[model samples]
Every structure is written in C-alpha cells, then in structure tokens.
Target chain A: MSEYQLPAQFEEFSQARKEGFLRAKAIKDSGGHIAGTFCTFTPCELMDAAGVHPVSLCGMSPEPIPAAEKDLPKNLCPLIKSSYGFAVSDTCPYTYFSDLIVGETTCDGKKKMYELLGRMKDVYILQLPQGIDRSYALEMWTKELHRFKAALEEKFNVTITDQALREAAELRNQLRQARTALMELQKLDPPPFTGLGLYKLLDGLGFSFDLHSNLKKLTDLTAQLQADYAAGARPVPPGQKRILVTGCPIGGVLEKTVKVVEENGGVVVCFENCGGIKPTRYLVDTQAEDIMSAIAQRYLNIGCAVMTPNSQRMELLPQLVEEFRVDGILEIELQTCHPYTVERYEIKKLAHDMGVPFLALDTDYSQSDVGQLTTRIAAFIEML
Target chain B: MPVYSIGVDIGSTCAKLAVVEDGRTLVHQMVMPTGWSSAETAQAIYDQLERQGYCPDSSPCVATGYGRLNVPYAQKTVTEITCHAKGAAFLFGTEACAIIDIGGQDTKVIAMADGVVQDFLMNDKCSAGTGRFLEIMANTLCVDPGTLCELARRGSGVSISSMCTVFAESEVISLIGSGTAKEDIAYGIVESIVNKVASQYGKLSVPGDRCYLTGGLCESPYILESLSRTLGLTVTSHPLARYAGAIGAALTAHGLARSERRTSV
Candidate 1:
C-alpha cells in the first residue's frame, strides 16, 4: 500500500498523457487501471471528495470519435471527435488510469460519449440534466453525492459515514467562506484582491480536508474582514467604479485583466466563471438526501448561463447589477471556450442595451500573456 | 425606396456582420464571439447587428460560417469560401486568384476563377494556422499578434512539432525555460503552424494570376512569408482584408441586388 506507483517510463504531465500511447503500442507492455476524462479545465471536486485521484482525461488524438461519428453527424463539434478519439484509438489515457469511468452530461457530445466508449471496463454516468433548475439542481447534486459515496465505498472498501460528511462539510464551508470573503474584498476601493488570490483560494474548495483548524482559520479571517468591512475602515477603493466580470475560467492572465480594471479605478465586484464559482460555490449540505444535489444547487448560485441557465441567473444578474450598482460589464472569453464566447455575446448586448457599458476581451488560456487584458480592462473602465 | 442587405459571417471565433444599403456598403460591422447553443450564437449575432442599425425588424440578412445553421434571421446562408471568393473578386477583380483564408476556428485555401470557388481545402480540426493559432502563439510568447509576428520575422531557427494548443503551449514553456531564444521559438512556432497548414492544404492547385490571401491570418506576415517560402508561392494581401468574408457576403448581396433590380426593370 505504501509502495510508489510512479511509472518507470512515464514522467511529467505529457508523458502521463502519452503513457497510453506507449501502452497501446503493444498490449502486453503495460498493466494498470486506465481512465479518460474530458479535459483539464474541469476538475471535478467530487472525485476528490471520494478520495479518488482525478486526472484530466482525453482520448488518443483529435480524431473523430469513430463509434459516435456515424450517428452524431459529420458537422458535429470537434470536441466530440476528440472524445471518440480516446477509446477508438486505444491510446486513450482513460484506458490506463480508469478502473471505472465517470462521465457528466456537460455537453450533448459528452453526455452521449459514454456509449461510444462502451468498451470501457465500467462506465458510471451521473446523469445530469440539460438545464439548471434549483430544485432539480439540488436533486441532481445529491444523487451524485450518494452515487459517489457508493462508488468510493465499493472501491476503497470503506464507508463514507455521516461523520466524514460533517467533517468534509465544515472544511469545505471554510473554503467557501474564504471565497465569499475574497468576493467581498474585490468590492474594496482600489481592488485589494486579484484573480490569482481568488484562484488560489478556490484551487481546493471542493475537496474534503481532515484539518478542522485550517477551515476555522479561514473562517476567522473572513469574519475579521467582515467586521472591518462593516466598520467602514476598508472603504471601497476611492473613485473606483464597480463592475461584474462574467466569463469562463479566466485563463492564466486574468490577474492582468483585473489589474487593468483596478488601475483605471474599477473594482471587480463578483466573478461569474466556471473556474471562479464552481469550486467556491459547490458546498454540499451534509443533512441533504443527496450530497451531490446540494453541490449542484450551490454550483447554480454562481449564475452560470450554463450548468443552469434560466430564471435564477436572469434575476440574479439584474439583482447583482442593481445591488452592486456596477457601472459596466467585462466579459472575458478564452479562445477555445465557445460556450462562454456565446454567452458573452448575449451579456454584452444586454449590458449595452440596458445602458451599462459592455466590453469583451478574448484571449488564450496562458498565464503570463495577461497584459493584453490589463490594457482592455483599463480602457473599459476609462470608457465607463 | 432604397434596398438594404445584411450579411453575416458566423466565423469559428467571431461573427463578422455587415449591412449594405442600396448596394453601397453601410459597413455596419460586428465582431462578436461564437459557440454555445445555435440559438445563443444567432441571438448574439443578431444582438450585435442591432448595434449597427440592422435589426431583425428592419433589414433582410444572409448568414455564413461553419455555424450558419445558428443564424436565425438570414434570408440565405452561404459558405465563407464562396463569400471570400466573391469578396476577393470585388477587391482584386474576378480574374484568377487563390484564397488563403485563416479564420478564427479554421484555415481555408480556396481557388477562385471568375469570382467563384473552383475548389478548396479546409483545415478545421486543429486551429494551427487560424486566428486561434495566432492567439495561442501570441499567448505563449507573451505578445500581441503584431509583436508575435515581428518576433518570428527576426529569426528562422528552432522547430515546433506539435499542433495541439495544450501540448504546444507546454513545449513553448519548456523551451523557454531551457533558455531558447524568444524570437527563435516564435519563428519556429509560426513555421510549425504554417507547416501544419500546408499538410492539410494538400497542394496549391490553381491557375495563378495571383494568389490572394485573406482572412484573419492575413494580418500575420510571418505566417504568410513562412507559408509562401515553404510552398514557393508569392502571396498578395490588402489592407482591411479581415473584412474579406464580410465583404464577400456583401458582394453576394450586391449580386442579389442586381438580380432583383433586373426583375423590377
């Protein structure tokens, strides 16, 4: 149990990705559990909650998913082809690290992707609905929780008892509070918090941590900040206009973009992104019928037009706009993320139509190239 | 009463839309993001168009792109290849021209004779030579597209093998960490992108009066020079060539305008 399982050959993330290529070169060359996941952008916290190490999974190459191709239509998104490319080529990373493959209905392709990978040893899908309804969200999240618990229990031969839930809940609550505090800090005039700090806080918000003190410490920090914030000691940065940022995961340089706004006297009030909200918002209620449902419900709180894209968000954004009195809108679109790009278009027009200044910044997902965002964000603030 | 035609190019990365009034370019252009639902894409395209005085209520529209299926209000949808050829013909006369269009999501090499498509090869699977590729390389090199191209022009050393953004980004990082010259990597990177492009674009099959380059990558001189050098062909480009697709769509509208006038006459 204590022995290191690092492959003698595979090293680094790319090596790990290509290990299947090596393994597939000859069937008898390697023997171990193989798994494939969609991509690195989505890091399922639930897998960590179950004490399972989750890795970003993809198929062998960007080739079409052969099995689904005939039925899925030729013009289907390239992402689908890449998904099918995993199993059909057998050089899929999922072929190695996965004893049981779990898929989410994030997209139509991924939702139906499991059927194409039917050759996989055991495929477990946590059936997710198309849209995000609050009640349904709760139910869905809870179902995932129970299912994950069952799977983890079976895999590890250990029970995910109520105590574990409470413990995990408390720790997660600490992370959530930290995130909420960071959101509050962004409201500070001159913008004290950066996207990098928020990213760091959310980096592990979904997992179960055994340390009670760690969460309590963060909770204390938030409480202190709240008290300080209430006393009006930390005034909203002087002359700064408040704005709500809506986008997918801010690639590497989101900090630069935020800085651009801050430098121009605009403070970011809330971050509406899958990366920004998913980790901080996905805190499961320990007492629920299904923990996964609670997680999904919490996920909905971030107001993603995806995950759940109806009334709650429509109401929430306007409310946030009014409550925060945000002067403008900045929608950052990572080049590859079509979902956010589409959404930004809607948000931009809505913002402009409503007389709120709207601007969109499209960039790649690398960290250091953030200066471009800084310039545009600063310009946006200036215009506002 | 004067007539108006709205043309939309539902590009891979962005939707380029233009409005023409009475066969004259009103030039109501929109560059909006794309993806998500077809409804969402159409809504976005329409909403952006609204900003330019062309609303669903006011003007007739045409749509084109890989995502033409998403544009709701279009009277018709045409391929960008056809649109680019039409646009190119209007710009450089409808003689013989080979179209090299590097859009956000896809790269297309089109042969046009008499302002129409003869044949074409498109590379859409991986965005190696497209606008997306430029964005990625720019991000990797920590520069804007203009600067990234300039850096590539400085040195012709090094080699980039992978076309995958995920892998290529890592490769660039590792190379940089190992003290590879920034410009050399940039040169190699652009070269590699153009190489992937050439692989997909089987051969430059055309009756070459002139090989006209248009689309997003038309702005990347480094890529253009590298492609031309690799394929041993001289390329021609014009200012505002990014508008080729939109211009082409407008040209098609102009053709429609003429046909309708003849019927009225």
Candidate 2:
C-alpha cells in the first residue's frame, strides 16, 4: 500500500476508489474484463452493461512525458504524453489491468498517439466527426456508437440488452444529478465550499466508480453546506472574486494554475473544462425511442474543442456565467493544443460581448511558470 | 492628525521602502541591494525610519514582490502587479495605460484603466528580457551597466546574434576576441535587449500612446532611446520609476489604515 493518506474529508471516497482498483484486479484475475478510456467520447454505458468496468484515465503527471521522447515529439500535449508515459512505463494500475483500452479521435495529437499506444496494449479507436454542424455528422457518430457497442459485446461475449443500456444511462443520470447539486452550491455569494474543494470532489467522481456511495457523499456534503450557510458560515473569505475557468481539461493531473488562482485571493466557482464541470453538466436522454441515438446526441453536444464550429459551446458560456454568478472568466490553453488555441480569438470575443472581463493564459503542466501564472491571476482578480 | 503609511517592495535584486502620508504626499523613498536577506533589509529600513523619529511600526505596513510574505511586520501582502498598477496610476493620471516593468528576475507588461489593473503578462521563467540578463552581459563585456549605455551612444550599427543571456555572453566574448569595437558591441547588446523586450510588449493589446516604462533598466538613457527608436513610441518614465512598486504598496497601506479606522469608528 502507498504510504500517503488523503485528507480526512476525502478518506471515504479515496478508500472506496482504492478498493475499486483491487476489486477490478480480482475480477480480471477471475477472467473478467476492465476497459480503460481516455476522452468522454467513449460510451461508458455500453461497457458498464457488458459487466466490464469502464475507467477514464487521462494521464496528468509530467513524470512520464520524457519517456515518450523516443517516439513522440517533445512539444506534444502534456496530457497525452503523461497518459502514454504511464502506459509505457507500467505505472498506471488501471491501464495495466485493462483488458482493452478505448480511445477517441478527439484531437490530432491524441489520434496519432492512439496508433502508437496500440502496439503496447490491446486498443480500439473510435472515430468522431470534426464538424458537428454538418448534416451527416450526427448519423456518422450514431453509426460509430453502434460499432462501439458491438466491439464491447464481441470482446466480452455478452449481449447488452436495451434494458441494460437504459439501466446504465439511468445510473449515469444519477451521477450527473449529484454533481449538479454540488456545483449549484457555488452560486452562493460566499460559497459554503471553496473552488478547490469542489474541484477535488468532482475529480474524485471519475476515479471512484462507486456511483451510489459517491452520490450519498455528495448529497451529505451539500446538506452540510446548506446547514453551514443557514448558520451564517462562509467558506470563501470576503474580498475574494468569483472566477470561472474555461479551457482544456487540467485532468486532475496538474492543478498548479487553479491553486495559484485560489492562493492569490480568488475563488474558482465554476469550470467549463472536460474535467471540471463538464462531466456532470448533461444527462443522457433515456426517453428517446432509440436509446443509442439519445446517447450519441447527448455526448456529442458536449462543448469540447474537438467539435468544429462549436457555437453550442459559445452559447453555453454566458448561461454558465449567469448561473454561477461569476465575476471574471479565465481562459487557459494548454501549450500546443491547436484546437483550443485556434478558438482563443472567438472565446475572448464571446466574453467581451457578454460584458465580462476575460484573461487568456497559455500555460503547460510544468512548475517553471508558476510565478508568472500567479502574477497574471492576481492581476485579473484585482481587476474584478 | 496626519496619518502615515509604509510600503516595502522586496524585489529579487533590490529592496525599496516608501513612506506616504494621507495617501498623497510621499515623505521618503529609499532603495538598497536585497542581497541574501530581503526581510532583514526591509526591517533595517524601518529601523532607520524609527531612529529618525518616524514611527513606521504604528502605521499600516504593506509588502509586495517575490519576498513579500517574508516581512513579518507587514499587515498585508499584495502582488507586484497590483502595486505596480497603483504606482503607475499615481504617477501618471487614472487613464487607460500599459506599464512595462523589467525587474531583475521577472519582466511584466501590465494594463491599467481607471486606476485598476485590467490584465497583465509576466515572463518570470525567461531571463532574456530581464535586468539579470543585462547584468550577465555587462559583467562579460567588462563594462558597468550604468556606463555601458553612454558607451553605446558613440557606436553605430552592429548586431548581436543570440537572445539567450548565456549564448549572448559567449557571443560577446567571441566578438571581443575577433577585434570588434567595444562601443559597437555595447550598442549591439542594447539593441538585443530592446528587441527582446519589444517582442513581449507586442503581445499586449494596449495602444502605444499610453505606454509607461518603469524598473531599474529605465535609469539607462541609451537603452531607453533604443527602445523608443525600435517601438516608435515616445515611452515615458517617472523620475522615481524604481520606487513605483514601493509607492503602490504604501498607497495600499494608506487605504487599509483608513478602512480599519472607519470600521472602528
């Protein structure tokens, strides 16, 4: 066992998460399968129904990035490098226990990295259309979703019935509802919890996989928050501005930037990134006659940079700002992530049109730029 | 009764102390090398003030810069970005302006409007466009940085190839060994520093008309002239440009003191 222990509040969830990896390993030892995924584009519903545990493991540390130097360029996205590094170095237990690794064509860097990852592990790549606005894109993605379902069924030797799929979608919906309740507490002026607190809580959801228990914990935490607020207690101190961070996922790997914002006297009330507020932002429409199409539609509507002409993302930003009562918007772009970097101009313009102050910071996972990041964030807060 | 405030800016290379009264009149400003201990240097400055019958300890004290938190006596610690913006606004009026500050270790280009910091960009990791970069190049050239600019004024067009401080230092050594004129090399070094700074300044969305320059490098006339010729904007600097951050912290101290007094009242 690792010598390190988590904070007291996170103990229950952390313990449950640690036990999950062991249980999944035990099941794999008994001839069961565990599937590892990268992006959210991989449908977890299908895998969950096939009696296979689907785990989203986006590599977050820079420790393994140098190991990837032999094959990949030095300037590739740190997220992909860290994930590939973990796999190559046999550092990630989830990737090791995974019978199959599922990947998506989210960005160019990830697309090529998947091809290289295939040589090291059993891998399946799902193709996603770049432009969601095109008429054929929806039909194309639906077909891809069907192929994903078939691939899981064929590999695991179990048929996923419509009832099983519906049940999986229902479980995911419960997780989303729980997450929404947690994010809603941030709307309070002096929120009951700090932004870092909510970020950690949401980050735990991806790894823990114990949905029912995690939901209970989230519900209990929110209840405690309500009671605290009722008794005139506030977690965020006075003079702290509410900040909304939107950009590529920090992936719970490198939180240097978020910690800088918090430490410099600002509260990050909401996150629009894949890792932050996005995972629980939407629920699958199980009521649709064709449940597969429903799943495809819900996930595709996600405001990911992978989607070309992503106006829906722009449409969603102002609403999030209003809902979260955000004071300022910070747009962070990971170094060399072309899709998000290309969208920088539009995002800034959107923030301007909405009458909110916006700061665009391009940074990486390295600790080298921490001071610079702190100065910029502190200045942004001073403006608000 | 006249209330006083003290602001200390413990920068990477130098520590500055400013004393202000009623948030307007600047009573005194002092600058000294930060050396090994910035907090001790700051405390020494306060001790000197106390010896001169100025009770700085009773006043609201504020600190800024990399070593801000080190000053145990400070009631509050603010970032240099905010302090710089406040200082620039005090010097120039409350107009929309951009302040380009080149410190020993970090270079900052901060935007301000209506006496508030709007946005800022800092290059702390890169030493190419900073005061430390020039210090290294000057030491290698065997010329004092204060006198290097005067020497550069006598020479005409010669270009330095590298922007990296270490590489530039080696290039200077090579140029000296190859019988290149020291004056021309000095001019080339100034040009290289200007070019490095201009590239980062170009990233700012602010207009050039309102650009104000601060920091230790502003003390060199030839370098400032080169910057003007390169950027085509008559960049202006305050007579007390080096004390801007300290003055900003002093202003913050004054405001905090008044607020606390009001709440107590």
Pick the DockQ winner.
2
- CAPRI-style class, candidate 2: acceptable
lDDT (C-alpha) at residue B254 in model 1: 50
Predicted structure with the largest lDDT when compared to the true one: 2
Candidate 1 runs further than 4 Å off: A7-102, A108-124, A132-148, A204-217, A220-237, A253-256, A259-267, A277-302, A307-309, A323-325, A366-375, B1-265
**What is each candidate's DockQ, to 2 decimals?**
0.02, 0.40
- Expressed as tens digits, the lDDT of each residue in A307-384 for candidate 2 is 888876888889999998889999888888999988988988888788888987777768877766776777677678
**Clash pairs detected, candidate 2:** none
For residues B70-125, write the lDDT of model 2, one tens digit per residue. Answer: 77777887888889888888877655888989898888888787777766777736
Model 1 Cα lDDT, one tens digit per residue, A158-188: 5665555555565556666666665656655
Most TM-score-accurate candidate: 2
**Interface RMSD after interface superposition, each candidate:** 19.3, 6.1
